[model samples]
Structure formats: structure tokens, C-alpha cells
Target: MGSSSSPSGGGGGGNGSEKEGNSSRPRFFNKKEKSICWAKAETVPGRHPERWRKDAADNVVCKRLFNCLGCLCFEYDHIIPYSKGGESVAENCQILQSRVNRFKANKDEVDTTQLKGYSCDIKFTDKELDIIEMAVYGDVIRPGNQCRCRTVAEMLGKYKSKDSTAACKLPQSSESL
Candidate 1:
């Protein structure tokens, strides 16, 4: 099977064009966003950082295992899920092994409470947190001449600091009557 390709064409390798085609495809995350997510996942408290350590020759090797059960490999995932309006910002993104990402695909939310012995606390900037709250909990309803709404922080019973409130605004349906 492999020798047939070399014998038939043999000029430029078929693999070269295939690589170029793949390079033209759009990536889910840009370079900067990917680097940020990778950095954040590296600080998950109990995860093995050594998995990404540089080798003796100063080259880094990917040592990520299959899923949440193993060590870290780099696969970026959306914490809030894109289908649920989660933006591709750093806060909404996370790094998981390929298997873990596949297992968690497209779920609206991840129930971290059930993950025993795993202490997971992902840090988010105030603005990112606000966006998450709005996306997950903010509600808009038009009642007669006015629109009624509640912020995600309010629904979650968490107090929203004045700074956080002012930093992000909920989507306005019709000029907050």
C-alpha cells in the first residue's frame, strides 16, 4: 500500500499537499488564545506539571495521557460550550487531554461537583466572569412597555461588586425601559 504511491507518482510527495491543505483549515483557537489556555491549564493545582517538562536536550515532549484519568496533553476546550454561547475568550477556554474533550463535547455545563478528589478552580478575570454569568444566567423578558431582567450573579445568589457590574453590561433588548 505504501510503496504503490512512491512508484506511481514519485515527484512531490503526496503527503506534502495533504499538509498544506490541513494548514489552510481554520483553527478553533488562535495562537495567542491557545497559549493563554495552555498556561492556565498548567496551573490546575494538582495536575502533573512534569508531563510537559523539557527533555535533556531542551526539547519539550507532549506527555498527556488519554483523558482526565491521565497526565496532561494539550487540547483546548470551552468551559461553557460554544453551542451555549460561550465565546472563545481565555476564561471560557480550558486545556484537556483529547479524550477528556471528546467525552465532554458540547455539554451546556460541566458538573465539577461530582469529580471526587480533584480540586478544580479555574481563575477568571472580572470581565470574563461577568460574561459567563450573563451567558449562563441573564434573562430578558418584555412585559408590556418595559423589559425585565436579572443578572447571572443575582440568579446564582452571588453578590456582584460595583466594579464587575460596570465592567460588563447585559445584552439590551430594547433600551432597558
Candidate 2:
């Protein structure tokens, strides 16, 4: 039998501030914890198994979308809320869509309805999804003929402009080539 003291367990720290060298629970999950959390959830097909995971709301979240402020993005969340005495560990971690996470804030909730209410309703085709992956991450998970959609830019040549703000420069149309 061991003894433990909870800051919230009918007691208060003097002045709520004290010199406790490295005693505070970690505010974030370590890489190993994150991996464990991801593995515990259902996997998705895109990219790699570890790159995608189902959020608490059951929405597919991509690690590539880390810190993004919308759907399909995710942030590591404290399942029990650190402020509410949750420890930072794999057992206490989850990935939630950015919007759902922000809305959830510090509340320890498992309500699928509340979480889903904040998710986006947009549906995307696989090629559009690949385009987004390219735009945001500069790499595509699906390559070659596997993805049937073609970019108008495809019939057109690849961009030659160096400046991002400059208009996309494609070589003269095939008729001129």
C-alpha cells in the first residue's frame, strides 16, 4: 500500500505555487506514448499505419495535419484532461480532430455527438485528397495511375515559376510545342 496526494483531492497547495523541481506532470505525450495511443486505435489506408489514426470522435485524423485548425487534422489530447488530474501517458492520450479538440478544451468528455457536431461535412474524392496532401505536405500518398484523377495542370506542363505568388507558368500548349 502506497500513499498519493492529489492536488485536487480535498487539499490545496500553499498559494498554489511552490518550488517543486520537475514535479509537474508532463503537458504532452512523448513519442512512445503517441505511438502507443495510435496503435490502440483503428488504422487507415493512406500513407502509413502510424501516420493515420481514428480520433476520439471516430473521425480519421492524419498526423501530417498536426496543428492544423480544421477537419482531418489532429492534436494530441489528454483523455482525462491534465487539469483534472490526468497524467500524461499512453493510457491517458488520444488524438482528436483539431476543431473537436479546441471545442473540447479541458473538459473530460466522451460524447460522440458533441465531438462530431464540430466536424466538417465536406466529402472528398481520392484524387482531391491526394491534391490536398500535395498542397499541404508537398507529397502525395497515392502515386502513378493508381489515382485516376488528373490535374488540368497535368495536360499543362509543370510550373516553372520560382516565386510562389507568381502565376503558375506552364510551357506553351501542346499545339505550340
Q: On residues 77-170, what C-alpha lDDT tens digit does candidate 1 reach at each position?
A: 6676644555555677665544344445566455543221132233344333334333433421122211224456865879654533223344
| Candidate 1 clash pair list | 64-72, 64-73
Give candidate 2's error at residue 27 in angstroms.
Answer: 1.6
For all candidates, the clash counts are 2, 0
- What is the per-residue lDDT of model 2 for residues 94-164, given as tens digits with 9 covering 90 to 100? 77777777777778755889888887776555555555655665444442322222355744876343433
lDDT for position 72 in model 2:
81
The TM-scores of all predictions, comma-separated, are: 0.36, 0.63
List the candidate 2 regions with Cα displacement exceeding 4 Å: 1-22, 45-47, 142-177
* lDDT of candidate 1 at residue 104, scale 0 to 100: 56
TM-score of predicted structure 1: 0.36
- Weakest ten-residue segment in model 2 by summed lDDT: 1-10
Backbone collision tally, model 2: 0
